[model samples]
Target chain A: MLSRVLYVDIGKRSSWVVDKHDIFSKYLGGSGVASKLLLEEARPGIDPFSPEAPIIFSPGYLVGVFPCMVKAVAMFKSPLTKNLGESHAGGHFSSALRFAGYGALVVRGASEYPVAVKIKDDKVRVEMADSLWGLSPLDVERSLRESHYEGMQSVISCGKAGERLVCYSNVIVDRYHHFGRLGLGAVFGSKRLKAISILGTGEIPLESPLAVKEMYEKLNHEVVLSGKMSKYHDLGTSANMLELNELGALPTHNFKDSRFKGAEGISGEVMAESLLRRKISCPGCPIACIHLAGLRTDFAPEHEKGKKEVFSEEVLLPYNYEPMYALGSNLLLSEAKNLLRLIYHCEFLGLDAMMVGNILAWTTEAFEEGRITLDDTLIKPEWGSVEAYLQIINNIVDMKSPFYAKLAQGLLETSKRYGGREYAMIAGNNGMAGYITGYGSIVGALVGARHSHLSNSGYSIDQKTMNQPLSHEQISDFLIEQEDWLYALYSLGACYFCRGVYTKEAVCEALKTVGTEKTKEELMKMGKEIFHNLYKFKVREGFELAEQEPPKRVYQVQTPHGMLKAEEVKAIIKLYIKKREGEGLRLKPEEKALKELLR
Target chain B: MKKALRFHIDVLHPERCIGCYSCVYACSRHLFNTIDPSRVAVFVRLNGTIANPFSVIACRFCKSPECAFACPTKALQPLPEGGITLIASRCEGCKTFDCISACAIEALALDRRTKLPIICDRCGDCAKYCPHNIFRYEEMK
Candidate 1:
């Protein structure tokens, strides 16, 4: 009975709930339902920042009911990629939304002034939030938490970057987690929306309690007692640092070198031994993968009567593989403390760490190449200079000058203007993730829906091929197969980290317990169809495969599998295109209605 | 005859809590056959920092429970296991909810639909499912 879809019009300051039984029953939920809604709600070729563009939040069917099913999917037209903007985050959001008795929430239209949307179960209120207009993401969360449900509700807010409409800005979820990729925060800013707070105390009845308990215990036992997930709980994905570095697959210094010599300095082992504080989890997840680092920051001395002159405060910041790679080796920053400070600034400003690292790296290289001088950049950009990077982050958020304004648009566009398209290290106008592994990685990223590493994990495929070689055809087939199945798992709201546990069989069994029955073959087919549907939206929004070529920098590097040429990557992507659609891309909208498609 | 050994769930290591809320969900699933926070007897909340980040609220199982004494409808009664038990039929769904205020630990919650007090029955489900060993089920002295 997960059929409720809540629509809130920010411009009209009104809300309504609609029964989307056909959507839920046919498409399942999460990204599947989100895709359908996006096509229906957003007008074709409309500007992403337009008030009419919709921000759809859909928590999959399994969310709030199963262990590790903690993610909620955010679907919007990305201001960054200017195509389909999709991101998933884990926190209290999915559970809160589920218990609020809705399968999905769509926010449409823009407001004239800054406001916050607060939903306590069915009661939705759009209130003026002028006081929270210029706050950082962390400060906004703190302010909303204190004023709302006494820190019990889930809150998502944008930083100054988002408010300023930085194309690469992100939305922080419940302080630690985020709708990190694309530019959902920019969308929030475009609507003049400040924050969203949700609290739910409603009940969802279990159809067969004993059956659910049996299935739950089985999965929970596999998750906790198996010791397979110990790596995730122990050091989190930060553990990948040493492994990827050893394999020489780690992207360092703008993909100049495949391995970082200072990898050990910022590896998870060192972080855990020296700076690790406490680990927390999203609701219902036993794996506490969110690792916090405690850094003692000193303030300038303040002289006062009977008071201490200098003060120090401990700041707890979350760290993960992507940011560690992006801010650490990618910038030649070796020290954990220095990297943490830069990451803290980026998180505080609400910028995507991967894009920020890519942009700064490109800027440094561009500075050295004399493509842009001190006139364009007020301060000289250098490698491993934390102060310079911090100032640059602030400048980008503040939109300090015309050059910075272009840089804030993302490195792809900035490089286009500043004359360094070759080494921009971007695919599809989105910055490259920290994986310069090989052909599968670059080709998969170039053609993947969001141009994200997580979209297909092509880097992982490349790593596996180090021992067993995968031909260009094999790699293409593997990426398409993996991407398609992943769409199905995502629609189920499984956290990316927990994908190993929620295998196709486990997914089938879990759904059965909830009175949802889908055969294994049907699930796989659903995955393929969902991926096609996503690509359909992307292509409709002017995404052309011919334009998304792997950057020249990727060709210059020596990966673990040795040198990768552009031809091999192009061949792989071309093969992927052929296999994904047979001959040409499907541009024509289906003559049949969506309900008929379900039939 | 010797009285049966009484057991109660206790917070043994609050420092180890990852704030997963497995216990809260487990309590709800075991008692109500649903995923309902309003019907659960345990609650966990984020405190917004690395140092002492999460606060866990669960029944302390008082011997002479003030909640039972404050119950005007006689819905709450002291159990031998050192916690209060709710007789849902006897609950009048009153407006005041004096029992909720009487509990000093703030462990008591009312069902949004039924308005009956949600009290721990000493089932130890919360302790059994806790991944970090934050809760413990032990015999009361």
Candidate 2:
């Protein structure tokens, strides 16, 4: 059993189980599995905060079977993004839940009061959590651990951000890792769920012992030795700062510029030298891409009298490249201590740091341009002002003022309210993170997905176009292939990190272990079918690819690569629409052949 | 020296487990049997959010052996190695869920077709599978 399904309804305080065999088999679990479940349970046009919005958690098939790098996805109608929202968090939780004999957990309705679910093997006990309701994730974790059996239980909790229904609130697992995107935490809070504790001791059987041992040993060796994984292990995602900055793709000051002049201050090299303490791995992951940074802060206060004492203090926690880029260079905060302070505020508030940073950057630009007054704005954020940013972050979590409440709603809503649609740097209502590489596949992916970059990176298309100019038709074909491959990976419930290790042969082999005798070609075809299905779903849900384009700033800014002309970009969009229609109609070669035969 | 040793296995340190399925992989690797996690002697599951942690459940290796007392076929026997072992050959395939209900810990599972009791023999192979030292083997004096 990959996982067991646990269903609970907060409305009636009732719970039951669903086999979910069909879902698990088709999607191979994780986000793919959860997305299907969400679609079924979550009806369109329903308010995300309504009782109808079901929250589902699905663990990957490989979670409790494979070694390391297990991730579980949380899916719901996002209050913030206001679309199909799903977020993945890598930790011991998913693997443990699978081991506990559950594949998925779905919560529906709303609790009358705050409550926590504690599962000890087969027996589940719902405990009152009135005291733990407004506690931060840290405090909640500490309290729950004390009450539960020592060394045997884990707790998941939300902070003040979630309690206040901040649209970017995240569900914090352990102390650091989270389902940090698409406002899953807000969904949990809306359900009045405080935390869930699961404990189980069960075993999974395999058909071939010798084969599994061989595969595990071989895969372990490959992961540790692979160059792709080594880079992640060495500096984690922070390594990208140097690469993206050098490539002139790093978003700076709300993407007003691609390159940050103070890029050196926040490079992975600087982080490793001045802040990094150790690398933290999720579960059995060998790559261990999480770097725990130890930050020191020392700033002298002004005194009218004599001299003020200066002291340094250190704080340690995990930091990743996306958060660093979003909160650091994007906000123009060059000092490591100030950036760390902002990072800490995001964590404590249970907010998606990237979304918050992006929102702040946009607000700063708007403020500078006098598009919005200080009185009209939430906190009057200034570029590179750590003190001001920290105060704003606190205000959002605290829900102190009306403007702060609107700001807490996230960039999409904030921009809409403030008449900044043109300046709003968002894709699919989710703030864009990946640099302006190209419009080939990523644009289509952003437009196609609920909300994510993994739907289609199109980085390859950017690379190809850079080497030599390609026709729009050529770019469309390239994007279609990338999207198909990505769809296949998601369906397999495999992490992108394992893509290198689980090539065509490896995927086939893994499938065989699960009693599926699928050929690589057949699997690829199935992946393509899933991609097409998702594309159709988006269209049905009102996604228009032709309408989705990079913000105007992308074309205006002169990137290191070259200046992108608006007409060239628009032509690419037209080509993409043609290709999408061509694919949708299933008429590329066949249409040409029929016309030729008729003639 | 063939006296049956009375010992218990406690899943004490579950939080340390990353749930890599190392134990599951180890069991299947050694048993040459396909076991669903629902039937495995030991299992781990997520506690809550990704940042929260994991929970573990395994045969507590109860001293009284409620499962053995409840087994009508007398298949669940105390092993000399200090845990309960099942005699799969003697099982009646009755499809009765008595053992499942009798054991307070829910540690017993029945094989799919045979409907025979399946219990942990405490081979310590699970300890070998634990990559993070979440499980361990101990000998009684």
Candidate 3:
């Protein structure tokens, strides 16, 4: 009853609910449940855009039951990495699924026409979204909310970039949160799926009310009173911008420089003082880490007004370290308002800010080197110029030229054709994240399941070893240790920002109140199992660790320690592979046979 | 401190609300021993867009509660301590939730499963659990 899975077929326009107790009991929920469902629902070696490819949305067991456990996981074959497509988003989505009495929802088979799947408790309908197909994410959500459902609802939608099949497009959740890293939005587009709206009015049953209340109070007190999460509520993750820049770990101008001279202009402190309009949170989170900036844009174009020549309106856009680095320092657009404008445009187009920023940076350098011409870019790409970047954004979405179309494919493909592979600044075919710390950050991205910095947080380990020399073996050990434990926390669908609060013991205690008893040791073992499960799917799809090499640009930049050596990084990566395979984690013969049988 | 007669919850600072739903969760848990949005007395809503702050809806503890007057069977009664209390036996579980419409602030809502009005009894659980101190349970004379 606690682990019901809703299977929806878009081609058939039908849906059914099944009690997936075996999957939930073994894998738990969130990433674990979603990965298992993807394995069972997908055929090996099929194109990620294939209609039969499965998209699984799952909330962890502790979600909606424990404080700060607000994230939900999405798993599929990534159009970006061509491997495990795993992304986590924090919003009302997880709690919505919880209150709807389902642990996971899987969509299989593509629709011939654009559609929006609407769910109200037990009712599910695939409605025609003809009017909303071409709208932006914000417009799509507004249309669905105003015209379709009433009461509290959570909506996940894609926009024009996804419809164009841009490889790095993202799915926006509840207007602000997102499955931002991978190409889930493109996957939605490939299925002709515009949006999914959920309204959950069902009451969730508690195993023991008193036990839950006690644990909830304890966790809530730790989140609010302990002062651990106060920084997030005050300035959010953008607080890292100034600190990383000071440490020379912030990637600037496409990794040409490690620190930006104008970092203070767009720092979190300045944004909070001048641009911060409001702070919000996901449904159940008390920290309120989401910070929105108010950007006043002049809407009037050649209009005669009574008092002024221009009419302006203020718009709200969320800002954190990723966008701050991607649009601000990394692209050399240091002005806060300018960075916010670019972020708003990406949100409107449903493009991944980080990926687009990486692409733009690479193009700028190529243009400066005379490797690319104006005919290829349509606009002369330049660093620190918002106008040029904005024009490029328009071209990429419209696919104005062959070069622009290639740019929409992503960094790896764009660099391959454009002759800039050395400076592509990517790992595992995905654009490198905000961190450019050292070998740890680079190797972590290369080896990570989703090729994301948050996958292992190796950058933090690099920071810890800045003052002290750490062997490559020590770095590899630390990185794997972080990933294993983080896998467990992520399985609970808790926010990574709250990892400080949800220790292994804390996770164990919380799971018990929900009638699932898990010891710290068991939770850790489960983490390794889930990690292997993800690799199993990735390996089945022909993902190889040796094939994913960090771009040469990563080693060119000067980190806090010094310039990194390629040999040192390669040695660390080799050790990482040995450690991973030494754990006797090869795919079981029965599991492999089952996958083939499912196919 | 002065001894007071009527004690009820009051809004202190609406602007500081984060829309965490902790108060709603606490109220539901306190009343029904479960965390269900349908059974909650306090309602939280985002104001227009993410740019704007959140709004919290709770009983105003009106001296003459409109909810009490609109009930067909007089299931809702105004308590001496302020706010309305529901009489379970008198409640018809009717489809016509006139009490919900009669509330000026729209603080009252119907339980989706039970089809009965969820009236605030001024237990002050919402104020007790509010992390931002948006609510104040005061004794008014």
Candidate 4:
């Protein structure tokens, strides 16, 4: 019944909580609510790094209560696209913020000095963090742990890449989880906000405790007892290695080939058999899908311990298919340890692993093509060269070199500068997500709101397309409908992993427990409304529909089906723009208006 | 002399612990019908780093319970089988917070919002809900 929005003005070092009931109740939560806030608070022409531009973190409506509903969104105008920046992460962030008595947290205004904000229950403290400044998320965690950030606390911090204003820098949470795209970290750095620590002790009020318990048990049964959730439970999403490899849709060496020869080396089964040490989960998640891997390295023994004694030391890090694919197959780095080190470097520096992988892929191709030389990249980025990638990873965060400064802007901009725009393989200034699976994915990337694969769920459509091919109209219909459903689920704060659990019937039933009774039709309506609202925000922020173009590299690449035809890719993207513009009665007026303004 | 039976949360294989905090949620919901993991019977503190480390804070239910002895109001009564049975109604809030400081592992923490000490009820809900069997249920004679 109670939802509070905590607004912090860093320049003034002041904060306040406002009960924005109408906004929250309508939008529900997560990115939907945050998008509305961005519309209200963000000035249209202000720079993303300016004092007036705000960074908003909103927990989902069912965040503290619902099972598998874990992600919290950090929203802002993107420096990368200069349009919309919305990134999400899973950990204890949502639950912590909700239990701390706030539904949303907005950080506005740039601070004069480094600062870390602490939120414990109702009290918010803005403290100087000079000692903790300029450190990686991992190093900052050490300082935070020694202070009051122990025992049931979640921290969101930026690292060196962010401090250097890398366009694709991430806001890292709990080291492994991140709001991992589109320059939110730069916004944090520009504000001089180092980190946020939350300690929540209050219990969330449940409408019907018994009903909620019943739904949870059912969801748990679906998650644990069924084979549907087992892949995630066992090897995690990296199981896609063999499947995607067999699909011939594995993007290898900068989209040159859709298949990698060394696919088995970094496959989920091998990772589980060798490096997997633990399976961690976010709050209320029964699946425990996040696999923590152990990276073993030999180090010099102490003189007292003995000379010539080498011991293997294990450093544990968590990974999913996206990171593994981006850092492993795409870069042609087969060794597990090398992939782990590269990924850890990205994690430590607070760079989006997906974006980093894309840029690295492009950089390697550029080097091979002789467009950029060793002097520009500081290394000969040969295929399968982990050593070169390691050196370049350091340069990415440092951003001191001329080439590295261009790299910070992201693959699209950098490729344009270095003569590889055709092979850049990006959508809306964002990198591809380790999947060149099919036309659905490629088209979805181009046509998605804010150019995110997850936005339209084209990955699922890609799978569906493999079994049964669809017409351009059918694909467009699928994308629009899935987008609607996903928007609703995200608003409800339900994780997509539990898509099996939160079916239309299941979600409606679950809502009954939370004192909200709605037919599935009404839910779909809300989703459609959210879809329009997001487009409105993006359009007003100067996102031209024509700019969402399919790169030439996508057509050149091979997919599971065969060679993807240029006409097919172009037709799908064209139909997408058409349906979105001229169809759908509810949004036709706005779409017409947008068409007039843009055309 | 009769051999005594005891139960312990065998976290000897702490590496196996997924850091899920499922036990925490299970305990809190089963006990108070709430979702705050902090109010739960067990709390898992993840190092929150890319490099691994984590600690699950829970009462050991020791052979000799110091928290029980530290309570001036006799609010905490030691069970013969091990662990303490807390009588929440009988408790007058401890000024010294001796029960909290008495525990070697600091399993018992004070909820400053309510100014009340929180102690584990030795409810095995955590053991039941843990997906990985990280919390081994042990009965030793």
Candidate 5:
């Protein structure tokens, strides 16, 4: 059951499960497994929007059997960033897929009209979703959830944002969490697939059920008692606002400055006190990182009292450090409620808030510089003005004008068209995450297989150099090692939030239950092999590492450490390639450039 | 002085349940030697959005025990303290499941595989593994 990959061809409206024993066994799972599948199916130079390019969903190997290992990764050729595409969602996505008796779900081909794929255990059906196509993710979810599959069901859906093919559009898992970045939703839109509904009633067999149960109990108990996740469980990830602000690492006003003066206004402490309604946990996760923030409308006392339901709304928004920094502080919107309202719009529309934030930041700066006008955007961009931003967002989603259409394509492409390329702030064509800490963040993205900040925990590495004495070359070495190790865990279905708990030994222990036995050393080797495979796919897809250059804004912004250093980042990227070369890391034509640098 | 006590499963806080299904797995692992929540007695029902609180359902083990009395074959028996006990051999699954109706809370239902009533013996497995501690066990009341 755990060794099969489900393939769905929307053109034919047919689905089948194939045994991919070696794929899951060798790569483990998640993006690691997806990369190998993509290599086989997705031809180089194929249009990313073409039906031939597969949209893959691979749940981690440890998913459905372990706690906090809930992330299900989406792998595709990104429509937003234009290279290796990957996004992750938390909720019951992985569990649902596992329960539906598949290790991965590979979706290919385009439908003539909108449709939703339903997997009820062994049965698979593709139903027309013409009515559901243009609906909001929230509305679409409600409709499909009522459509009744067997047993417990979960829907992976995209909203109007995806239907409209917004490049940074997201695939929302359930209502709150998302495969939030790199435009996987846009790929779904291209395929004319609205959603994938799964009803799983299958059980994963454990080699030693009793020992597995004991292990699960031990990890479960430690989750609550240990202070390791106290921050996440208590105030949610938004608590990082004040902490990053104090460190002068929080992105403010499109990274003109790293710290926001009104940081306290939107801090996690304030949100938890003023607007937090509840803390929601992802499936199988004890540490509930998602915060449900309440938005109350101002009305007459009598009206407010009589119409409580209409006046008050609770939106399940993960007020994590990334979104808070990107949508809140980065754009200089200081109030928590305003940020909540804006995030609710993004989440409801299925837009990637971080990418959207970067786009807004670049747009605002361009407008301020007089490069864009009211005629261009239909509004005068202003800092911290939620009203103005709201109008722009509508325009972007509607894409009525050429300006708004370009904006929908993400910051990089929009900047090229609008004459703000210098301030675009994108790396590897993908929008940057919230933090602008230092060289670590910039370099991590440039070298990242997916060009994600967490790809190697670059900002974390930057903070490391502050305390520990490590040279630039050593820093690059460390980052490379971490990326390799993290990819191993990511493939194994371990969440970055709980990676500390699912140590190599712990993963081996968990794997042994499901009939895979490997020592810690063997696991480490597997990690590096998977890391190389992802790079191989990227290189094949025309991602040239040596041709990569930092977005001009990376140098202009004042980081926590000080002004950014282009040469230092360049040196680090060079050192990184050298380290990879030492390990026989192969690239395509990009290998020539990197080799020349080595000489 | 220490004394052995009969355990009773109670949903102490239904509103706070996050529907992680940890309790279901725990209960199943103990009773069936497998990790199948459908086999577990306790149920966590999720509807609407995740914004809404999860509802955990289980037999409250009523004081009167109507399920015990409604049984035509005397298949349902009253426990010494609370809750109803099911005698597997004497039970009949066909021609209208009367005990499932007798349980007012809709907590007692036929297991999908076995087609027998999923009666909570109140073994305390569900409460022990509830991630949020939504369930509790105490002396038979």
Candidate 6:
């Protein structure tokens, strides 16, 4: 069946539908399909906040029916990185949307005034949202529920941060889950689009009912039997804090050291014991790995005073491993209660918590080194002080102070303005994540994505290749293969949690059900083609991987194993450049052969 | 007495449902021949906000049978045991969403390939799919 694409022009107050059968067949939906749309619609050198910038929401093929890990991809031109930007989030929203029958929604042109779009099973309507324009995501969701009391509907909207056009503003889906990177929310705000509400009742078709039944039974049994799946099912992503801390790979004091002494305070075990309330899963997921943490506000009084009052005196914040490490240990925050408060603030404010933590860490290091005075900056970093962190978060979202305005622009921009590229923890203009696991292959992956760890999670490299380090050339080649594979998974619209289950064979089987006649080998080749295409896009946009360099502090910092040298990291970069060249060469030959044959 | 065909199905209490697809998977275990819940007959949709929770959306087993009344080819028909049923052989692959529009509770869906209407036949298979007891099957009073 051909997937239908819905197009909305908020500026002209127009709505239309297109059945892009060719695009869906080739891209196979989700991010792959959305990227094709983005490349076609978004012009080079156009301001990300302009009407020309497109906001796209595309669901993976398995969304409405697949068990667990149905993520909706929100793609836009990023104001923060000023490059191709996409963020994936899982919630009830995407599945509901898919159930509603459209494969994707492309929103173009700004609304002349603030408005909201409501879609209810073949019925699409746009309503005035001037009253909701400046409302936080939480409020907008509440108002939507009160006004539109249709059968289970999900909403994706922005907060004050997006309305203010904060460079790192994220679009919040279902209040908690977010298209949480690259300022996609700001693009929505620029378009004066307040929210998108979808309630779908249409059903997707299954090819063979008997085959689907057998597949589910076998897959369910495998999931239950797998030890790896067990760990994730128990702790979710929060399982990494203690493990990374033990490896001395935890980013602490803003990357000054690889380990945090207070890691125990916020470890997964600690969170499980103190804060974990219940396990929540997205869409059709059976693992139910997400642990929604219950906050205990009264437990820590010292951390609760002053500017941190916005958080419920008794609150429950979702605790994940990376945010804890980034906003907690990385910022020298020791109290779990306080760390929870900081995380909550970031979510409510619609800021990318990882980038916010990275920028704050840089500011702290600069402050300690006397690069900036207290008068020059608004936030003061005291180890484990949640109140201080809250103050800083407010400043950034509001852009109330000069320091925060620059900080809100993100690490790369801040560093460039303040002369601190040596300490800035960013790659491809995006802030680095919390996984410090391997021989910096993860870092290389981050660089490759124009700065997204998920683009090529190097954690596996750190896990398997830790004992025997690879040469720079080998590392680069390995990363290219990993990156291509990861891109394929993303393109397939498959969740990373099922990376183990969706093996090459599984992927091929899934594709066969979708009517694609390609073998696993052919699918992989297509993935390679997509990877090279992304690289070409980056190059066309003036990214020089050969000249790309990691922050100096990465090399200087001492891990539990030892310190890495600049030359060692440079060799890795050289290897990456060579691999890229090889991929480029293969593409050229394929194109030439096709041309010659045609002639 | 006419022999009543027992079609396995489940009943959902929306208040008890957390919007999770556990039951959806349990139903997919029987229906789609794959783990993909999208193909399953039983699925959950949100009736409200995250704070308000979700509304259970599936076959409601209406007595008046709007879907059967709306079926152009009698593909959807009333069962002797009560509720509606789908006759695969009688279906003519019509894309007409008459049954879908006629469904007040929005339960009926057309199969992707055959374009035949699908209806809940109350066989009580999905009752086991719900771990939280949101779905239950009992002899009508």
Q: Using alpha carbons, what is the TM-score of model 4?
A: 0.92
Q: In candidate 1, what are the lDDT values of residues A1-599, reduced to their tens digit?
A: 68899999999999999999998887778888888888888787879899999999988778767889888899999988889999998888888888888899999989999999999889999999999998887887777674313223688988888999999999999888999989999999999998998887676689998888889898898888888688899999999888989888888999998899999999999999999998999888899999999877866545433344346678788999999998899999999999999989988888898889888899899999999888888898999999999998898988888999998888777877888998898888888888877888898888788888988888888887786668978898888878878888888888878878888899999999999899988988887887877888987787877557977988888887788887777777777777776724463344433445789
Greater DockQ among 4 and 6 belongs to 4
lDDT of 2 by residue, A250-341 (tens): 77887777788888888888889988865555655656666778766555544323333445556566788888888998888788767888
Candidate topping DockQ: 1
On residues B10-42, what C-alpha lDDT tens digit does candidate 6 reach at each position?
554666564567776555445544444445556
**Relative to the true structure, how large is the alpha-carbon lDDT of every model?**
0.84, 0.68, 0.84, 0.78, 0.79, 0.70
Error of 3 at B125 (Å): 2.7
Question: Which parts of model 1 are misplaced by more than 4 Å?
Answer: A146-152, A303-310, A583-599, B1-5, B48-52
In model 6 chain A, where is the ten-residue run with the lowest total lDDT?
Answer: A584-593
Docking class of 5: acceptable
For candidate 4, the iRMS in Å is: 3.0
- Candidate 6 docks with a DockQ of 0.21
lDDT comparing candidate 1 with the true structure:
0.84
The list of candidate 5 runs beyond 4 A from truth reads: A146-151, A298-316, A467-469, A588-599, B1-5, B69-72, B92-96
Would you list the clashing residue pairs of candidate 1? none
How far residue A409's Cα lies from its native spot in candidate 5, in Å, is 1.7
**CA displacement after TM-score superposition, residue A564 of candidate 2 (Å):** 2.6
lDDT of 6 by residue, A1-599 (tens): 53799998888877889999888787766777777787777776678889978888888876644454478787788888787677888776777677777888999888888999988878888889999987878778777864433223678898878877888888888766788888887788788888988877556566765555555555555555566477777877777887887787888887887888888887788888877766656766666666677665534445667545554445444667768878988988877777788788877777777887887788778887777778767657655667777887787777877877888778887777777788888877777888666555445645565467677666566656666766666666667776677667776566777787877886676656555667877777766766665554555454556566778877767664367676777777766666667665232334444787899
| Deviation in Å, model 5, residue A277 alpha carbon | 0.6
TM-scores for every predicted model: 0.95, 0.78, 0.95, 0.92, 0.94, 0.83
DockQ of each: 0.54, 0.15, 0.53, 0.44, 0.47, 0.21
| Reference interface contacts recovered per candidate | 0.63, 0.25, 0.54, 0.53, 0.35, 0.28
Q: What is the TM-score of chain B alone in each candidate?
A: 0.84, 0.73, 0.86, 0.78, 0.84, 0.78
